[model samples]
Target: MTRPLRLDALAYGGDYNPDQWPEEVWHEDVRLMREAGVNLVSLPVFSWPQLEVAPGVYDWAWLDRVIEVLWAGGIRIDLATATATPPAWLVRSHPEMLPSDSDGRRLEFGSRQAYCPSSPVWRANVARMARAMADRYGEHPAVVLWHVSNEYGDHVARCWCPESAAHFRRWLEDRYGDLDGLNEAWGVNVWGQRYTAWEQIEPPRRATGPVNPTQLLDFERFSSDALLELFRIEVDVLREVTPDLPVTTNFMSLLRDLDYWRFAEIEDLVTDDAYPDPADPRAHVPAALNYGLMRSLKGGRPWLLLEQAASAVSWRDVNVPKAPGRMRIDSLQAVAHGSDGAMFFQWRQARYGQEKFHSAMLGHRGEQSRTFRETAAFGRELQRLAPVKGTRVRSRVALVVDWDSWWGSSATESLPSQRLGWLAQARAWHAALHALGHAVDTVRATGPFHGYDLVVVPNLYIADAAQAAALEAFVASGGSVVVGPFSGVVDATEKVHPGGAPGPLRGLLGIEVDEPWPVPDGAAELVELDGERFDAPVWSEWIEASGEASVVARYATGVLAGRPAVTRRAHGAGVAWYVSAALAEGGLVAVMRRALADAGLPARTRIDPDVEAVTRADDETDYTFVLNHGAREVAVDVPEGAEDLLGGDATTGRLVLAPLGVAVLATPRAAEPPFVTLSETTD
Candidate 1:
């Protein structure tokens, strides 16, 4: 069982870097933190060099004093292991630990995560640092969470150094067992690339031409595993030394370099670092999708928003600051999607360093800045929301998120079209669902589906027989499904399934993919659904009806004219819908409405693109979060007998909200919500 974060109220604060300031400034920082109602702060994330000046040498005076001051001020700590980056001395002595790029150039030690994931030297040093931190402060009164190394695979996800090559060979040996098995799995017979020995296999570095697709896919898998191994090493030590405290490393939301599904399983608590761009008006749609994934990672448990910018981030080309009231709405949107509370990247803005320009809770103006004032007000809002701390968001719709499929579909450059990427396809589908006012939860392709009535497979580019069986079982048990294009094409080995596209799901979806006809650049395509034409871009396929399936939509233009662009079939007790083209937003919403009706679900008719409604509940009360992200005022319908938690007023019928407005309405819970039981469903 996963251990939850030990906290009385909802957590609030950010990364506290007392090491960046002198001891005299520490007291002032604590005073400001108290005024802001900050309860938890992640400390010393990148303090390895300061903690250990020399090899095996310690300097605990500064950290100990900082902790004492924080504890004295009644502030809780999310203590970090300070193993995010290697010290200059350690990297200077062991140059082999430095990571190298795919171009055979070694990356220096100036940046974070400069060490190679597969480096033994780096592993040993990090383990030592983790043990030392745990031994000293594992049982400290103020320390509630033990945060391991900073975001894994943020900088050096893959390294082409000699050490990594050796590690990859060992990993492949353990996976494939022998040369024949390896050759068979990799399809090495093609291009005369059969490997006679393990040494012959190398990391897919700069090649003369296109490399083996399976090799690239395996390397992607290996890269994720390598970083995961690093995290496991630190977690094992932390668990051994400090078994009570929950251990977590902040996850980069929707990051493709590392697989979060496997990583979340090892964590005691799942946390994420989210920075939705302030420039994009519709960024909240995708942000909701990411938060949904985080909550579902542990079966609808609440996750923490560990790090978000107070205003504009420094990394974008033209960093745009959040408008006046946008910060509060942004933070509340996260809480609405099952985040316990909101936190930022840094407590105080850095005067010097790479992130000096990045916005922080306390900007360069200290307590007088607008950022701090907004943060303090938000803190008060969280205190008011004390009743919503442990509540989870129960969703009946499940969106399939498979990292293997994400990596496989976009890993190699040999795809039919690069325009239809995984994230784009997912966001398109999620936006449709969001506009329909349905709270969607994420599920792995091979997980239990009993808790959900509708499952949407945005794009499962890589799938096997077992995954197909799981979907079949879901449909057979009176559930609804919607699958996107270019799915069920390849298996785990990157080899095409025995049949063509929709391989095992051909019977379930009742369609056969004749060919994936990608639309030409600068070309206009259209698909007619229910006598209404919608623009179809990037992708369209020549699909054939193989089983007892109903043609729902057909291509109205181009060479595939009059071909089935969408199909639906009834499998046992449920129905399955498939899309053979990348339809526009209007078409997607129309299709989703039909699927919802087929499953006896009511699709919201308002379609306010900028307004978001998400419900989270426990046993007795339901908290419905209504947020308006548009520039104009909007009126939202409130549940009957609902009371506003923030405004402290009873409201019913229509509640008018200004631009960038938010309201949390609390109402008596209707009925028992469904929960996912892993053992109830079979893969």
Candidate 2:
């Protein structure tokens, strides 16, 4: 198989819409882009209306001039297919192309991505647009990447329209063969919902009571595939026309609507648009997790930060701008996490549109804006840190991220507790691991567990037999594992495993779950670990220890007192830990620290709440990124014989970081301790 795409130098720029401005303003945009040391920009992302004009008629003169101007200014283009949104004329003629919500009301086409994924009309038009763009710019000197379409499923993830219903039925037929197989998979016999014919099936539309959980699960799977199918249509056209150029579409980080694992597998490269809320102090924790997933999507290949707000975003109720140095640190955070470079949503803030108020590289006041000054400085910093490109971030730890489990655990109805959300648990566990200073890479449940000492399963609500066996093999091979609650509950069909919770993993974890005992709302529960009390809220399980499993922590308060809130089992040469309660941050950290020790990894002595430390390495040198996200200035210990790349000075120890300050230290690879290499192959 061909490898994912990579850039020679650090990519630096944002979405550029020369079409949004006057012809004369295009010159100024390029001029400022050069001053900021910008080298790449994604263009004409939402230019379907401008390019197509009406029906088959075209308007290429304007786009030709824009590309010529960028090429003349020495800026590379991530040229879009200009199919993000369809022209008004097409939507007018084919109103049936518009999407419908779950309620089955046809949505209007006023905003972007307003078309149904299953619409043949929309697919044909987009494919045509992709071919046109590739035929025109496939060999253009300025074009480096072929941006497929804008973020898929950003606005319309799923459609309940008649066309979508038809597509879903077709997909179901292929997935489960005939009626008997479908009946068995969905267990439709429960409520007299078994289908006699394929035509009887429809998209899971509005229903009086809770919809069949299995039906809902299938619908979610089908919806993700529908969007992926749309992407494939455009990708097939692009690759055929421009076989040499790499193609990609921006992914909304950790988006629930689509399975990015499948999407990334087909695309030539992975990219993401991340907007961690400025209002939340700890937003970066989850942002790191998202970035990890992006990098892991292509097996640790460097992805791009395709879009991030330069400052305040217009969509939030309270649009908070980034603090003085926050933008620089935020951009570097992406670099630290394995992004080749940073790019924003728009090169210039829109003068008039839904996103006009969104902050950009150039604001309304142009260069005089604070946003521009900070971003320009950051762009220069990116130039100085260019060598950091193409380097991989090494981690001995892996976290399981499964889309099926996310859908199963967060099913709108029939969940044991709505609070046991997949993302919430993922972020919570990742935060503790982050606090403990382990560079975490995300993995699928059925992992290629090579080159890692520890694997963590935050929650695996839909663990199948294969996934269980994979984890079992990992542990038997002497890799320590830490599993959180709500795992191994169901099979691929959403049917409960023959046994209770942790079904397939019962043998590996050495425990059988009697029942899930969720803590009541507004109630308090505590657990004792190592003779220290800690809050264990939201969830707990009635776990019966089988075999030689040992209880590591017990419920000190609540009705389930003295029961196992945490258990550990020695399997083969490795250890398996089960955390049955949704332990508070402190409690989770305590459990994680123990797991780290068991895996022969040293837990950091002190973890700063607002500081992040990450290392990226090439063959001969290690680049350590230390960033301070807190308000107060603090000093950090630097590795011996390290040179500060940003400061252009040699520093040995005691590197002080101002609030939001960042430092990149270069040290000889041999000087650092022996590192475990991550194998690219999957188990």
Model 1, range 1-683, lDDT digits (tens) per residue?
57768889999999999988888999999999999999999989999999999998999889999999999999899999999999999999999999999988999978788899999999999999999999999989999998989988888889999999999999999999999999999998888999999999899999988889898988999999999999999999999998888989999888999989899999988899999899999999999999999998888889999999999899999999998888899889889899998889999999999999999999999989999999998898789888888998867898999989998888888888888899999989998988887878999887689788899999999988788899999999999999999999988998887778988788789999989999888885899998999888889989998658999999999899998999999999999999998988999998998998998776776577788877889889888888889998877656656788988988755677789988888888876332111121122
Clashes by residue pair, model 1: none
- 397-444, model 2: which lDDT tens digit per residue? 999999999987776588788877888899999999888877789999
On lDDT, the candidate that comes out on top is 1
Query: Which whole-number lDDT from 0 to 100 does residue 200 have in model 2?
Result: 93
Off by over 4 Å in 2: 1-7, 670-683
Stretch of 10 with least lDDT, candidate 2: 674-683
In model 1, which runs have C-alpha deviations exceeding 4 angstroms?
Answer: 672-683
Write down the RMSD of all candidates, one decimal each.
Answer: 4.6, 4.0
